[model samples]
Target: MAVMTETEPPPPPPIRGRTLYRLRVLRHDPTALLGLVLVVVLAYLVVAPLVAVLSDAFRLQYGDEAHAGQAPGEWTGYYLWRVFRSPVSRLLFWEPLLNTLVVAAGTTLFALVLGGGMAWLVTRTDVPGRRWLAGALVVPYMLPSWTFSLAWLSLFKNERAGGQVGFLEAQGVRTPDWLAYGALPIIVTLGLHYYPFVLLLVGNALRRIDAQLEDSARILGAPRRTVVRRIVVPLMLPALSSAVLLVIGRVLGTFGTPYVLGLPADYRVLSTGLFQSIRDRSTGVASVLATVIVIIGVLVVFMDMRLMREHRRFVTVGGKGAMDRLGRLRRLRRPAFALALLVFVVSVLVPVLTLLLSTITRTPLDLSTFTLDYWLAERLPGAVGFPHGVLRGHELWEAAWNSLRVVGLASVVCAVAGLLVGYVVVRGTAPRVAGFLRQVSFLPYLVPGIAFAAASLSLFAVARGPVPALYGTTFLLILVMAVTHLPYSSRSGIAAMTQLGREPEEAAQVAGASWWQRMRRIIFPIQKGALVTGIVLPFVSGLKELSIVVMLATTGTQLLTTLSIGLVDYGYTQLANAVVLMIALLSFTMTTLTQRLTRTSLASGIGG
Candidate 1:
C-alpha cells in the first residue's frame, strides 16, 4: 500500500500474446528464424506422409471391392484383426515376428560380443597390429549388407535352394540345411556385417576415457577384474547402449539380408511381408505393417533416449589424462594376435574374396567351371539368360550412373542443410527454436529406413500446394536420402563448430569485418576438414543405402542398390555379385580418399 501510493499503479502485466510478440521482437536472430523454418519443414515432411499412410491403411482402395463385406473407409479393426488374430496370422505375422525377434536378438548378442571384444583389445590392450585391426574392422560396415549375404550364399547355398553347388558342396561337404538359407545364416551374416557399428562407437568411447582413473583404482587395491566391472563397464554403458540401439534399429528394418537369405526358404519377416503385400497389390495391409514397424522404431528410440539421460551418473574422472598401456600377454600374444587376424580374415577378407571369385565363376559352385565368360563375354550364351556380360551391361552402367547422381546430390544437399542447421542450433540465442531444429533433424534417424521410405512415398505421391508430385523421380530419391542422412552430418557440423570457438570470429568483428567476411575468410578455412568429412561421410552412406530407396525408386530412378536387389530377384547371382563389388569398391575408395584428404589438410594446417 505504501509503495503503491508512491509508484504509478504498477504497470499492467503483459498480455499472453503480447508477451510472445515482445519476445519475438527482442529476439531478432536470423539463426533462430532459420532454425524455426527448418524444424517446421522437417516435421511436415515426416509427419504428413505418416498421416497419409495411416489413412490409406484405414480406407478401402479402388481395388478393395473384393472385401465388400467390410464397409469402405469406415472405422473397422479388420486389417489389424486379420493380421493378428486370424488363422493365417500364424504364417503372416506370428511366425515371422518370432523369427525376426530371434534373429534380432541373436545378432545383437553376437555383434556386442565380437565388436566389444575387438574394441577393447584395440583401445585398451597392448595388442599387436592394433592399427591394422582397427582399420580392417570398419570394412564390413562400409560394404553393403547384401554384399555379405550374397557372399554367404555363394559359399553355403545348398542343393535344396536350387543353386549351383556351393563351395562346401564342391569340397564334398554336405552342408546342413540351416547353413544354406534360413534364420541361422541370416543372423550370422547380418551380425558380422553390422558389428563394426558397435566397434566404432564403443572403441571411440574407450579411447577417450582417461587412464589415470584406472591407475587410481589399482592403487586403491582394486583388482583388474573388479575395476573393469565397476568402472570400465559403467563408463561404457552410454556408448554400448547407443551401439545396441543403432544395430537393433538397423536390423529391424533391414530388407536385403532377409530377402537374400530368408526368402529362398520362404522365411518372411515384417519387411519381406510388407514388400510382398505391396507387390501383390495389398496396399492396405502393407501400410498397416509399415505402421507397426514405425511404432516399434519409435519405442526403441524412446528407450535409447532414456538410456542416454541416465548415462551421466556413470561418469569417472573428467580432465585430460593419459591412456594406460595394458601389459603384454607375452606367451599369449601370438595366439591373441592369430585369433584377431583369423577373425578379421573370416569377417572381411573371406567374404569379399568369395564375392570376387563368384563374379568370375562360370557357375555358382563349380570353381572348376570358372570362366571369364560372365565378365568378358558380350553375352553369356543366354544360358544364364541375361542380355549382356557384366562388363558391357547397359542396364548396369545406367544404374551405376543413376546411383552416383542421386547419392551425390543427396550428399551435397544434406551437408549444406546440416551445416546450416548446426550453426543455428549451436550459435543461436533462441533456445526453443534451436532445440526444436536439432531434435527434428534427428527424427529421421530414429525411424526405420523402410518405414521412412514408405512414408515418403505416401507424402510425395500427390501434390501439396506448390510442391508437385515427386513420386518416381530422381529428385525425390535425392530429397529422401538427404533428409534421412541429415542426422549424421548435423552431428559432424555441431562437433566441428563446437571445436572451433567464437574467439576468432569475435576478433574479426572487433577489427571491423562483417559476418559474411569472417565466415568466408576465416571460419570456413579453418573448418574445411570437418566440412569435407560431413559431406563425404553422408555421400558414402547414401551411396550404399538400400532400404531408404527401395519403396521409392521406380525403373526410371533405379539406384545401384535397388538394381542389385532386382538382379537377385531375377536370380542373376553372378551379375548381382559383380554389381555389389563395384558399389563396394567405389564406396571404399571415396571414404578412404576423403579421410586422407581431411587428415592431410589438418596436419598441414597445424604445421603452418
Candidate 2:
C-alpha cells in the first residue's frame, strides 16, 4: 500500500537479493571496487594536506600564542593581519607580491615570445637545422633550472653576496645590482629555463593545424598577414594560452632560480618569501604565503579548464587527408639558422660550459685558476667539512645514492599507481568514481612543488590515527615526490588507456582470469612503453628537483639537489657547481636513454 502511493518510498529489498545484486555488479565490474579504494586514498593524500595548510594559516601556532592572543590550536586572524595589514606587511607580503607579479609577467612574456618564435621557425619553416634544433632547444629544460642561475652568476656576479667575483667582474666589468640579481636576472634565467613549455605545446599545436585553412584564406584574397591573423592565430590560441598559463604557474612556484638570483639583492618573490618564513620557523606566515600561492595556482588551473572547454569551439573540421608543408625560408635561411643556433648557444651551450668551467676553476673564465680540487682532490686548503673533492668525498656519494634510491623508488610507485588510476578512469563502470579518480589524481599538477611540500609536511609530519609520523623519513620524501609528480604519469596513463580496448581484458576475464591476472598479463604488456615513460620522466624530474625536497630533506635524507643547495648556502661555489653539473649529466643521460627506448621526448611527454 505504501509503495502504491507516489509519495511513499518503495519497500526495502531482501537481504539476499541485495547481496546477490552487489556480487553480480562486482563480478561484472571489479574496477568499481578499485576505483572506490583509489578515490578514498587519493582524497586523503591530496585533499587532506591542502586542508591542513589552510587550517594552519588561521590557527595560532605553538610559539605564536602570545602574539596571537589565542591557544595554539585555536583559530585567529592574526597571521592574516600580520601578512597583509601589519607594519611588516611591506617586507613580508606586499613587496614580494609585487615582485612575484612582475617576475611572473615578465618571465611569461619572455618565454612566450622566444619559445613561440622557435616553435614557428622549426615546425612551419624550412630552416637548415630544424630537426636538430628542435631536439636541442629542450635541453635547457632537462638541466636543473638553477643551472642557468648559477651560470648567470658565474658570468655576471659582482661582489654583492660577498664571495668571489664573476667572470665579467673579474675582467674589469662592473655588473650592476639590477643586472646581476633581482627581477631582471630572475626573469631572464626563469625564461631561459621554462621556454621549452611554449615550444612543445605551441609546436605540437602548429603541427596539427591544416595548411589548407591558410591556403583557402589566401586564395580568397586574404593577404599573408590577414591569413595568419584570421586563420592561424585563432587556431593556435588554445595552445598559446595554455603555454602562457603553464609558464605563469611555474613562475609562481619556482624557488631555485629566484632564490639563487634574487637573494643577493634582497629580492623576494612569493616562493622565496615562503621559503624564508619556513626557514625562520614562522609557521603561520609560511602557511599564509603558501595559501596565497595555492590560490593563485588554483586560479590558473581553473582558467586552463575554462580555456580547454572553450577550445572545443575552435576545432577544425576536415577530412583525414590533410596537407602539410613547411614554408621555405629562402634567402633568409642562413640568417634564420644562425639565430636559432644562437638561442641554443645561449640557452644550453653557454650555461653548461659555464657550469663545467666553474667546477674546475677557482675563478670563472680564468683558465689559470683551473684545478681538480673540486672534483677529485682528497683535501682542499681552506675548506671546512667538505674538504675532499666531490668524487672522493663520502658526502657526495651518499647524496647521489640517496637521490637514486628515493627518486627511483618513487618513480616506480608513481608509474604503477598512475597505470591503475588510468585503468579506473577509462574503464570503470561507475562514472562518479572514475571522475573523482581522474580529477583528484590531476589536482597535484595545479599545486606548486614548494607549497605541496609544505602541505605534505604539515599533514604527514605528524601521525594521524594509525599512520606513523613521517617527518625526516625517506618514505615521506618518496611519498611527496610520487604525489607531486603523479600528474605526469597519470596523464600518460590516461591517454594510453583511452586507446586501449577492454576486449583483451574481457577475453582474459572469460578465461576465468582474476583482475590482477588480466592486468599483469594483458594490460601491462600492452602499455609497457607508457609505464617506462612514467618511470624515467619522473626519475629525471626528481633528480633535478630542489624545491620539493629542499622543504623536506634532513641531514640523513640528503639528496643531490639538497646537497648542492647546502653547498651553495655554505658559500662553496665550485662544489655546488660540480654537484649541479653532475645532476644535469645524470638527468640528461636518463632522458636520452628514455627517449631512444620509448620514442618519446621529454618535452612531448610533458602535459601532452
Candidate 3:
C-alpha cells in the first residue's frame, strides 16, 4: 500500500456571536433549554404563590391592621403575637398544635401496626385467600380518607338534633364523645384509610427481599427472631421509613378527616385552624398558621433525609438471585387469613356499607325508613335546592360531569407536564436546572392544600400578565388540580425514566432524530404505561379532592367534591352520603378500568 501524507484537518470556523451561539445551543441541547423553561414556569406557578403567602405572614392584613390601628399595607407582628405569644395563643395555636400532634402520632402508629402486619401476612405466609386479601386491604385508600370519618359520623354522631345526630343517638344509644368525636375518631378513621400507604411500601419491600439472606441466617443457627432483628429489620427499614414519612406528610396536610371528625368536639388540627382562619377572614392568622405548617413539613422532610442518609449502607435486592420464599404458616394460615379479612372488613367493608346503607335508608337501621328518594325520585318536596332525586336531578349529574371534565383535563396536563419534567431531570444535561425543576415541582406537596388554595386565590384573583382573573373560573380549578396533583405523575415519570436505558434515544440522536421526534416515537411509547398511571392517579385523587376545590369552586363551577360539601352544609345527610358513595364508586371504577385497559397495577406505579 502507498503511504498517505499526514495532513491535518482544516481549522474550525470562527466563533459565532453570543446570541447565535445560544440559539445553536438551544437547537442542539433542547432538553437543557426545556429544563430551564420548566424551572421558570414551575417557579412562577408554585414558588411565587408560596412566597406571596409567606409575605402575608409578616405583612399587615386588612382585618388585623384595622383592629390594630395600622394601615392595610403596613407590616405588623400583631397576628404573630396573637398566634404565639398572646394569652389567646393557647386557645388559638398551642392547644390545637398539641391535639394535632396527638392525632398524627396516634394515626401513624395505628396505620403502621395494622399495615405492617397485613404486609407480612400477604407477602410472607401461606395464608388462604391471599390474593383477595391483598386487593381488599387497599380498597379503603381508593375512597377519600375522610369517607371513613363521614361513615363514622353517620353511625356515631351524637348530641345534635336532625341529621347531625347519628343512628346510634336516634336508636336511644348514648354514644360517648370520646368514641363519637375528637382525637380517637380522627385517629381511627385516618388510620383505616391511610394504612394502605404502609401496606404498599412494606409489602413491596418484603416481596423484593432475598430469601437467601434469611436462609443463610437460619443455617448459621440464628433463631427466627434473631434473623428478623439482625437481617430483615435492616432490610425493611427503607420501606418502613418511607411509609412513616408518607403518613406524617399526609397527616400534616390532611384536612377533611380531622375536620369532619373533630368539628363536633371543637377539636382542631393545624389544617382546620388554617381553614378556620381563612373562613373568618383572619388573613394574618391564616398566614401564620400556614407558615407554621410549612415549617413543620420542612422539618419532617429534613428528618426523613437524615434518616435516609444514615441507612445508605443498607441496600436490598441488588441482583437476580432474590427468592421470595413463602413461609409455611401451616396451622396458623387460617388464623392469618381471618385476621387479614377482619382488617379488610373493619377498614373497607364497614365504611362502605355504612355509606351505602345511609344513602338507601331515610333513617339508619330502620328498615321501614328505606326509600329510593335520594337515588331516583323525581321530586322530594321536603328537599332544599335539589328538590329532585340524586339520579334524576340536574345537580349531581352536572357536578359529576364538571368533575370528570376538569379533573380529566388537569390529569392530562399533569401527565404531559410530568413527562417533560422527568425528561429534563433525568435526560437533560443541565444538573442545576434539573434540580430546581424537581424541587419546585415537589414544593406543592409540602404546602397545606388549604394554604395553597388561599395562596392561589390571593395570586390569581387578579389579572397577572396574560393570565386573567381566574378566581371563580373552572380553568382556575383545573390549573390548581393539575399543579397540586402533579407530584404523583412527576414521581411516576421519574421512576419510569430512571429505569429506561437511554441507548434507544442515543441511537435515534445519531440518526439525526430531533429531541421531540425521539420523545414522541420512543420515550412516550416506552413509558406510556407510566404516563397512563400518572394521568389516572391524579384523576382519581382530584375527583374527591375537597380542600382545594372547596376553596376555589364557585356556584357556577361546582365539582363533585364541592357539590357533596354543599349537600353536607345544607344538612342533606342522605343526599351527601349518596354523592360520597358515587365518588367512591367512580374512583374505584376508574382505577379498575385503568388496570384493565393498561394491564398495570396502580400499586406498582406508586411503589415502583
TM-score, every prediction:
0.87, 0.93, 0.90
**Span of 10 residues, lowest total lDDT, candidate 2:** 599-608
Residue by residue across 1-608, what tens digits does model 1's lDDT show?
A: 44545546867677997888867643443455667777777788766778877887777665665664665666556677667887788877788778878888889989999888888777777778877777877778878998889998888877776646577776788888788888998889999998887888888778767778888999999999998998888889899998898788888899999989998889888888878887786767777888888888988989888998987886666555375445467787778778878878888898888989987776654668788766777866544546566778677788889988988888888887777777877887888878777787888878888888887877788797989999999899988998888888888877787787888887887797766677688877887776777778888888888888888899988888988888777777777888899889998888788768776321121100
The per-prediction tally of clashing pairs is 0, 0, 0
* Model 2 misplaced regions, further than 4 Å: 1-30, 317-323, 602-608
Reference-based lDDT, each prediction:
0.80, 0.89, 0.83
lDDT by residue for model 2 (520-596), tens: 88999999999999999899899999888888999999999998888878778888889999999999999899889
Q: Pick the candidate with the highest lDDT.
A: 2
Measured over all alpha carbons after superposition, the RMSD of each candidate to the real structure, in angstroms, is 5.2, 3.8, 4.4
Runs off by more than 4 Å, candidate 1: 1-33, 65-75, 170-172, 208-232, 318-322, 365-367, 383-385, 427-431, 464-466, 495-527, 600-608
Q: Rank order by TM-score, top first?
A: 2, 3, 1
Among all windows of ten consecutive residues in candidate 3, which has the lowest summed lDDT? 599-608
lDDT of 3: 0.83
